[model samples]
Target chain A: MNKKYYRWLILILALLVLTFGAGIISLLSGEMDIPWHTLPDILVQKEGIQYSIVTQIRWPRIVLAFSVGGALSLTGAILQGIYRNPLVEPYTLGISGGAALGIALVVVLGLHLSMGSYMLPLAGFIGSIVTIFLVYTLSFRRGGININRMLLIGVMISFVASSMMMFLMAITSSENLHGIVFWMMGSLDEPNALLIDIMLYASLAGLFISYLFARPLNALRLGEEKARHLGIHSTITLRILFVVASLLTGICVAVTGIIGFVGLIIPHIVRLVIGSDYRILLISSFLGGSFFLIVSDIIARTVIAPNELPIGVITGLAGGLIFIVVLTRANVQSKIS
Target chain B: MAVYLNIQQLVCGYNLGFQLKGIDLKIEKGAFAGIIGPNGSGKSTLFKAISGDLNIQSGLIEMNNKKLSSFSLREKALKMAVVSQFNEVLDVTVEDYVLMGRMPYRRNFQFFETKEDLIIARKYMRLTNVYQYKDHLMTELSGGEQQLAAIARALTQEPELLLLDEPTAHLDISHQVQILNLIQHLNEEMGLTVLIIIHDLNMAGEYCNHLVMMNDGNIHQHGNPHEVLTYQNIETVYNTVVIVRENPVSGKPVVFPVSEKTFKKTTNTSS
Candidate 1:
């Protein structure tokens, strides 16, 4: 038992170190190569073109990457636990599609021009909230929320939302279409300090609240009925977890458009390495996701030098490849052992 | 003896139809009782009602003079633990799975299992003979071992009453005997109240001091094994011909199904 605890400690520490390394790389490698040693001085002095670039541009993006990535992965872990299926992620519930449809509608109607730039994320949030409410209410039965029913409803809603989004995209002008497509592809280049702060705090709070239910989540792995037998109010626990995860995913999608694979891939990788004990899985997936996105953001920034790729593109490519490799390797190792 | 569980006029079922009709039963404290019936006889429904899985439409279920409905899920868990017939095959290790029994005792904001919880879990693991498999994954264990692990987890709950639903259903004879013997030992040595649902009438008759026979959601008979396992009640409830005889070793009532040939020959001779 002590050894198992020690292993968790070491794995968490290793993930922390790796995340820190990724953050440093993200800071140093973007656009103009900022020297590693000058980082501390630039932070304290707070005055130069380098300082402006580091503080005004790169720092917020890094924090955004961390929170958005962590929040998505954390949401994925919670959703997977509730559904008891490894494939269930934030997107499976259609939150991303809802957000995308919201953004597309805002762009098509020229709401961002009339209302303000913030209208985009506001519409996105509103869209996701509506989707969540629909899914939650539609699937609720006389006794409680049937999980399988909810999954099916979520998938159906996602299809409808995506179809609506495509309809809007087809009718809109080329300029509006371009805006909608870019937002759908996703990026971390937000200039709003307030949004960044909200994302960071919300992600951390999501982690903290999710940690409180870690034991229940662990009990849930034995299946919902068994969890209730073990004294967990499965219905209440699942409802609260669903809200928490959906809100987190909603916030993430609103801010970043739709960063796809972090939510699906990070938790999968973390579970493989650290085991599925939610006590460790939650925190580990959060850190692993932050690390993955920070590294992916660096590649997005530097791979083309002057021309930057959408952060989502890098994440999808890197995350998908990594997941395939890890799964195949795990399959092989399990067969051998 | 004081009654541990009392059910009066219990009527409960799913939305399609009522599975358990008006049923009345009482089990004294520390008694090893078994409920036996054929499929769709409401044995499982009754068990679910008592375990708080199914809400009774109209009736009362009391445990130790307190209304079972009044107790919270956590409170019910504290008083009784159930080893369900089918548990999901999970990726968790045996030790971690067994430690989940301590969940009801976990205080709010408690992140990890307490030292005392670990000790209790270990004690039960040892008792159930799953100590050696503690580090092994639950999926790696045999059916009997998994059932033992489940029982160990239930034991770790330190519940006053232990309920099992056909625990030996899928096990081979040796494993069946092993599980029943352990249950009997727990009942005798620790004074635990056991209420089990068993398909095998002979095993129920041999192991249980008290037996309740059910037919169509109502109690067909309830008495000592000798009285409850009579040929008349067995044939009427199960719709089969069975001969009841006293076992030579334990002297408990044993049931043997009459073969078609023997039944025909006996009928012909009698006619």
Candidate 2:
């Protein structure tokens, strides 16, 4: 038992170190090539072009990436525990589509121009909230929420939301269409410090709240009936966890447009490495996601150097390839053992 | 002995038309009782109502002189632990799985199992003979082993009443005997109240001190093995001709189904 605990500690420490390294690399290797050795001096000086660029441009994006990635992945792990299906993620419930549609509608109507830039994220947040409310209410029966019905409803709503988004795209002007598509692809270029701070703090708070229910989440792995037999109020647990996961996903989508695959892939990778014990799965997935997104962001900016690609493009390509490789190796290793 | 579990005119069912209509029963403290009946006989529904899985439409279920509905889920879990028929074999280790039984005892905001919880879990794991497979994932264990693991987890709950629904349905004969023996030991030595839903009449007769014969959502008979396992009751309830005879060694009743051919041959020869 002690050995197992120690092993988890080592794995978590390794992830922390890796995340720190990814953060440093992200800070140093943006469009302006700041040298690694000069980082400490630049921190002390605080007045050069490099200092301003690091603090203003790259640092906020890095913070945004960590929180968004961590929140999405954490929500994925929680939702999977709730639904008991591995294929579930924040986006599986049409949260991203809803947020994207909201942003598209706002851009086409030129709401951001009139109301200010905050209108974009506000619309996105409202849109996701509305979608989750619809899904939650529609799947609710006489007294309890049916998980299978919720998943089916979520999928159908996703289809509906995407079709609606496409219709909006069809009627909008080309300039507005460009804005909509760019936002849909996702980016971590939010310049608002307050929003970044909120995301960071909210993600951390989500992580802490999730830890309180780690044991319940583990109980749920035995199925809801057995979980209830073990003394968990499965219905209440499901409801609270559903709302928490959707809200986190809503906030993430509202803030970052839609960064796909981190939520889906990070948890799978972390579970493969560490066991399915939610106490560790939740934290590890959060850190692993932050590490993955930071690295993906680094690649997104540097691969094209002057012309930056959207972070979602890099995340999908890199995250998918890495997941495939990890899965293949895990399959082969299981066969060998 | 005091009545440990009392049900008065219980009426409950799923929305699919199956219902347990106005059922009343009582189980004495520390009694090894079995509920036996055919499929769709509301055996599972009755069990569900008692376990708080199904909403009781009307009537009262009291445990230890307190209404069952008054107890919170955690309090109910502290009083009774259920070993269900089917459980998803997850990727969790047996030790971890067994430790889940300690959930009811967990304090608010408790993240990990306490030392006391671990000791209790290990005790039950040893009792059920699953300690050797503690580190193995539940998916890796055989069906019988998994069932034993499930029992170990239930024992870890330290419940006063242990409820099992068809625990041995999927096990081999030897495994079935092994599990029943363990349950009997828990009942006899620890004075745990056991109410099991069993399909095997012979096993029920062998192990249970009292039997409740259920037919069409109501109790057909409730008494000692000798009185409840009679061939007439079996034939009437199960819709089959069965021969009930005494076991030479244990002196308990044993049932033998009389097939159509044997019945016909016996009728013709007698004529």
Candidate 3:
């Protein structure tokens, strides 16, 4: 194989090994001290409380972290490509704000699960879809979408959604306010099997679809007009990416609340290491995101031990540090180059 | 040679009320053409219309006797390529940027670049002298090197027709000549028709066989470079006095704008 192919293979293999290592570490370090030796037996035998904790509660939580991380990073990479801006991420266009509003309203009305667990995700998905459509329509000029206009309008809408969510919070009973507030801050600690199931299929399908469009995404880096001259249908590609990214982001947010920075920081970190060809960036982002979030979740659990901190806070600190480092390194590299 | 691109009564502009009116032009196959005009003369606007990035109010553009609108975006791209006036410094490598030019020919779902694709990319990179910087980030290159990489990417399309908008606007003198020379070489050796918009009159006069000069959204002059690059034509269209001379080397028309200070000093001395 050529040097390029060799680099890709080595990077991927390294990520897989790190992800497995992180996964095992996550499985071992929870509140219940399940020894590393018991892991294989616990995984195989489904009976007893040890098996119950390992299989039912802990495994689902770990998978949720991985799936949610993977989904957010994939959408983040797609958003950055479509907008042709490094600062853009899944929520940069207000997908998370819409989902948060949807969940807040659901909580205020006590309509989270009168019917089933799917209702919450459905609500969040609808809110996200509506927000995307609104931003798209408003940004549509005579013939095409204006990305800057969409970005500004998205920020405006996010402000509106946040106020509405605050209003909903003001009217809610004090008893329910704590749960609502904590959820809004983001957490992967919820052991909801149904939410995990929802994220599994949607995130997988989103990754597959994103992989297929990687070629167009790469073309778009040259700017929209040039991408058009290179056979990419820019408007159609943008529209599809908008919908898919919003959906992935919406579902992930609905399940785990508004997890910040994983979407933004993972893709940038991956790009810094591997460069910005979306084909490699997309796959490596998923792997990197999974690893990063699993590690973050581990820190969230162990740093405070028995009490458990929100995964969002841990990611916020870690992501911020890494982002600062990347920016500084980029500054130095540009000066030298 | 047969007429390859024909634009007739091409009325188009960004705003509805402001438009290029009754513009008609034709370029023969394998011809090197240049469009030169003052700012806001609708030179770039005309390019947008021909490339199908802008909707024409009323008129038609034909390529190879087929209506330009008849081709799908992909079909249009397969037949023609454009190097737009892009200025952003992205983080992509030079090799990847060049490889993107093969997008029109690739199946989108196929993730891996074919062996043929790599060969084509490397060939164009070497041609543009950007192969040495293949692994460097795009922003790492100088403005001139980046411009060459952009041209190399456009050439990877292997198009029959190429449209460029002020491609050499940012390059230094030597790199400007190098890029224009490479473009001329492509046109002459490969039989590729080229339409370029240029701000430098001398370069336009030197490189183009035919020139189209615009003023107030109208084609003021369109003919051989020697006819269009005259002193009277430049003064009339540009509202500025210029001395037009012949270059002794290639015998092409050369233009020099008379600065206001020089004009005042000469008038004062004569009086």
Candidate 4:
């Protein structure tokens, strides 16, 4: 590979290594330290000293960290491609607010769907999809959907949804309020495998769908008129984008409230490394996002020690720092575009 | 040459108002035709109507032997390619951007261009003398290079009818001559029925087989360059007196803009 290619590869690989390394650190050193050698025995065997401290609790959280990391980054990458706006976040379609409203209302209502385990994420998923469909139909017309109108309508829907959440929060019992508040803060340690599984599956499904759209998304980078003139139906492409991205945002948001900026920053960082080609950008963004989120999750766990910090705070902080580094690092005005 | 397109009682305009009034014209197949006029004379407007970019307000258009609407967009694209104004798209490679012309023909489910498509794209890119820059970022190229790539893109479509809007709009002298000569070669070798909207009267005189003069959206005259581009036609249509002479090398009609003193002196004495 040439210098440019090598640089990006090195950075992406380094990020991946950091992600895995951080997860390992989080797994081994959290609260109770299980010796590194005994960790394997806990994972593989039924007869060995049961290191439940390492395997039972930490391992699942580690997997959740990796999966959620990948999911958040992929959602951001796909959103950037469809919107053709580098600054666009995962919630451009109002899925986060919609899901937030659903989850918040459910929490405030004292619904113990965690008993079923699938019900909470399902509610969030359904809410996001419904809102996405509503936004798309409102913006779509005889042929194509207008991006500005879609964004505006989504934000409008988000505002209304936020108000509804607040209104529901106003009347909820003080006891349930604590859980709802923590959930809204966004967390990685849901301690519920079924909910995490649903999100993991949804994220994987969304990623697969995004890969299928790689070629069309590249054409769309030239803007919709050119994309349409090139024989790809702009309307249909936008619809698929809406639904797949909605599924991703819905599932992620349902599981972990609202984690901002991962979607906006990850794709741009990938694009800077891998030019504007959607094929490369999409994959790299997925990797980078997964790595970024994993690393952030580790920091969230370690920085507060016994006290847990919201996953969103870590992401927002990392995203802010990455954005500044990306902007200032290169002669970006020329190389960036 | 037989008539390739016949437009009758056509009115073309946007929602603001009618730009092109009622018009009637016929373009012969394999003709290198140029429509020349001053700005706001509806030259581009007329072409848009003919190309179906703007809906014909009131008219019947017959292309080849069928009504205009009978042919689908694919069929029309196969017959015609439009090289619009020299717009810039510097993000893509020169080759892929050209391959987009084949979009009107190919399937759209994210398949890369077939080998045949690649060969065609390469061939046209080479023909336009932009093959060396096939992998180059479009933004890195000069203005002339971009225009040439756009022409290559239009050619890659392999259309029978080539409609260009001021293909050499802002190019320097060498680039202008290069585009005109390249277009002339395409017309001669491929028998491509070329219709270009150009403002350069001298370039049109030398390159076009037939010259069409438009004034206020209606054809003022149309014939072989020698017959139609007369001093009287120039004076009446452009409201300017001009001397028309044959070029010594090409033996084509060339116009020389006349000063007002000469026009006034001649009109006063001769009238």
TM-score of chain A of each: 0.97, 0.97, 0.93, 0.88
**Candidate 2 per-residue lDDT over residues A57-160, each given as its tens digit:** 99898899899989999999999889988899889998888888889889988999999878999999998998999888887767777789899999999899
Give me the TM-scores of chain B across the candidates.
Answer: 0.98, 0.98, 0.96, 0.93
For model 4, how does the per-residue alpha-carbon lDDT over B232-252 read when each residue is reduced to its tens digit?
988888888789999999999
Q: What is the docking quality class of candidate 3?
A: medium
The better candidate by DockQ, 1 or 2, is 2
Docking class of 2: medium
RMSD of 1: 1.8
Task: Candidate 3: list runs displaced more than 4 Å.
Answer: A112-122, A330-337, B264-271
Residue range B141-206, candidate 2, lDDT tens digits: 999999999999999999999999999997899999999999999999999999999999999999
The whole-model lDDT of each prediction reads 0.91, 0.91, 0.86, 0.77
A133-203 per-residue lDDT for model 3 (tens digits): 77878887666788888889988888888888889889898866776788777888666677788898889
**Ranking by TM-score, best first?**
2, 1, 3, 4
Q: Top lDDT: which candidate number?
A: 1
Model 4 chain A scores worst on lDDT over the 10 consecutive residues at A225-234
Tens digits of per-residue lDDT, candidate 1, B36-141, equal 9999999999999999888899999999999998998899899999998987787778999999999999999887788899899999999889999999888789
Of 1 and 3, the candidate ranking higher by DockQ: 3
Task: List runs of model 2 lying over 4 Å from the truth.
Answer: A330-337
**After superposition, candidate 4 runs with Cα above 4 Å error:** A1-29, A32-40, A46-72, A104-123, A142-145, A163-181, B1-29, B37-79, B86-88, B99-119, B211-221, B226-248, B251-271
Backbone atom clashes (below 3 Å) for every candidate: 0, 0, 0, 3
lDDT comparison, 1 vs 3, better candidate: 1
TM-score for chain B in model 1: 0.98
